[model samples]
Target: MSKQHVHGSHPDIVKRLKRAEGHLQRVIAMFAEGRPCLDLAQQLHAVEKAISEAKKTLIHDHVDNCLDDAATGGPGKSARNVLAEFKAISRYL
Candidate 1:
């Protein structure tokens, strides 16, 4: 199947990536300083949650804009494709 296009690469996505980078740097520092396992785990969990939230935001935007546009003049194929992609991504989350 052809790759589905999504409307991302927006300013918000870029900002989220920058924040995630900062979070990762802190995680590295925590490892270097021999931080407590529980503390490190908590921070990692927060990072994961942030990333997940960002992803959902991007996906929702794409569904609302890009996918909605693509769904026109089809047998609802574009919508089906978008739903399939979401399902696949949900497995990772």
Candidate 2:
């Protein structure tokens, strides 16, 4: 069956990811320039945080939309589908 396309958070996630990508480029440039270790570590921390937040946002969107689909009005909301989703998201824990 064809998958449903609910791109509610796609644009927002893309913006966040792009922001993180810019930060990562700056970090790489800073590293090459022999920036101070403390400053570099701080920049690295920011990059990590941005990426982590993006990951969390994507996971939240997936869980919200996909679980709602399995439990409500979209399609194929059988117990099996819900169980499958639960098992799939367990890897994130």
Candidate 3:
């Protein structure tokens, strides 16, 4: 099957991931600069949460679009495949 979907969340998710990337880079730099543990932990936590949120958004978009389409008899998909894909993605939750 084609690997593209019509979801509108892709750009938002990319922006979120980029923000998380920036946070991660700053955290790495802070670690190298000998920043305090608490400050570093907070920034790292922000990065983690940003990434987690982005992942959730992407997974939700996929489920709403892809799985729903497949379940509704979209071309080139089967119930077993949709179930497998849903099972695979649920691990991230």
Ranking by TM-score: 3, 2, 1
Q: How far is candidate 2 from the true structure (C-alpha RMSD, Å)?
A: 2.3
* Ten-residue stretch with the least lDDT total in model 3: 1-10
**Candidate 3: count of backbone clashes, pairs at least 3 residues apart or interchain:** 0
What TM-score does structure 3 among the candidates reach?
A: 0.88
- How big is the positional error of residue 55 in model 3, measured in Å on the Cα after superposition? 0.5
The TM-score, computed over Cα atoms with residue i paired to residue i, of candidate 2 is 0.82
Which pairs of residues collide in candidate 3? Answer: none
lDDT of 3 at 83: 97
As for TM-score, the candidate ahead, 1 or 3, is 3
Q: Which digits, one per residue and each the tens of the lDDT, describe model 1 over residues 1-93? A: 998653555678778878988998999899999999999999999888878878877767766665566566444466678678657755654
TM-score per candidate, chains pooled: 0.69, 0.82, 0.88
What's every prediction's RMSD, in angstroms? 3.9, 2.3, 1.9
Q: Pick the candidate with the highest lDDT.
A: 3
lDDT of each: 0.76, 0.83, 0.92
TM-score of model 1 relative to the true fold? 0.69
Q: Across residues 1-93, which tens digit of lDDT does each residue of candidate 2 receive? A: 997765789788889989989999999999999999999999999989888887777778877888767777677678778878867875764
